[model samples]
Target: MNKFHGIFKQLFELQLPGTEALDLYEGYYAQLYEALTSRDNYDIPIVMEQARITGGPVLELASGTARIVKHIANAGYSVTGVDISDDMLAIARKKTEMLPQRIKKNITLHKGNMIDFQVDEQFALVILTATSISLLKDEEEVECMFNNIYEHVKDGGRFVFDLLDDESFENSSLRMGGIDAITLNQSPIPKQFILMGEQRDANHSKRALMNFYSEVIAEDRTYRFFGSTEKTYFQYDAILPIIKKTGFKIIQIEKKELAKNEMIYMFVLEK
Candidate 1:
């Protein structure tokens, strides 16, 4: 075992206290991915603490629905978010519209892939949360992504991100009851079902698709969106060389049990 820094426990509180079962509604693809995603409000505090620790303007890559970035903005930090999907950005934009004017000006959203996304400004911290980078799977993709992150990060700045390994997800299929949402600026997500499919491999890389049959109930209205999220085994050892070559030094590596049987490896890298 290796230890880099003293154990720092209890950063912030978690919202997903586990939900009690309730009857679900019959609906379609309308829910904004809050039910089964990090939007469930459990992981938000961890990422928020990361921002608080680093204390700077943030540049978040692969910013799906711009969840973490939005929260960072709400906390009074300036943030620039980049994502590849227009559909995801649209949902994020809708949420952004509901934020206060001051917070609205604090956030900037860009539609672009992680590999080649360009922003005019550099940030004191660059983040890739929700384990989104792990879905890249390919070694080259990971390398390119980090190289791009280096360019957007100022000297002596840090990059913090999380990686999820599909290998930890044991069940062939999994189910969770309706999560009681934490309200807006936080989420009004409702019921959801996630089926983690079998992993497929090619050229020593693995890919798994998590199919969500969602039935989300917002506060005032009901909406539902069924979607598939991809996960790939993130082999940190395989990418360590690439990361160092791109000029990032591993400052700290922390492991947290985000959920039962779900381990998250958070890498804090310094440029």
Candidate 2:
């Protein structure tokens, strides 16, 4: 078996250490999301331009913490943000509460699953940004999500999203066995955290699983350790047919190369 499968099996069968680590890890993700979106240029310009062309009301799937949706609403579009994680939506609600009434009035938050959801109205633009498309684990889930998106968007409306290219996964170091430290200056727990893991694909599916363990040392030298696993699937050739089958015509594709042998692909599709 591949290293990822072995690690995942271990994680699944064993009791993880530090029950509080899950809460801390969630807090870490919330802080990271906030910091990434606080920048002026995060995902605002690209999505805003699409919203302007397509016209609103806009719907954002997997709108974690309302990072991009809030900005889109602030730009004067009526926006709805949907996320399955209530913790993330709670943070989004708190942030939305602080916005001006004009902007706040245009924003709505929903706690729902993206694969199966219904809205009272259709949208001119539907978005799934920040590599959110990869969160769907398999072809069936992707199909379900695209069908829902099709239903939610008006005819001729636009759907836009970004994904991490397959090349990145192919080129990545699958055996991350040693300590990997990450430091975020803006995070409340500013000290570095250590991560170790491996990523590998499943035998019967295109899905890839990443099994990781994280540890951090607090200021007082308290040690917190956490274990987590994530699964995502993406391939340019494989996903294109799926999108086409869902009745979306690909309009534009943008590619960006990042450091560490990673790449990003942005796709704009029309219903």
Q: Pick the candidate with the highest lDDT.
A: 2
lDDT of 1 by residue, 9-41 (tens): 010112123322211111222233533464455
**lDDT by residue for model 2 over 47-155, one digit each (tens)?**
9889989989999988888778778888899999998877788888998999999999999999888899778899999998767777677778888889889988999
Best by TM-score: 2
C-alpha RMSD between model 2 and the true structure: 3.8
The local lDDT score (0 to 100) that residue 215 gets in candidate 1 is 36
Residue 34 in candidate 1 has what lDDT? Answer: 38
TM-scores, all models, native as reference: 0.71, 0.82
Please count the clashing residue pairs in each candidate, in the order shown: 2, 0
State the TM-score for model 1: 0.71
Native RMSD of candidate 1 (Å): 11.6
Off by over 4 Å in 1: 1-32, 41-46, 165-196, 202-205, 212-230
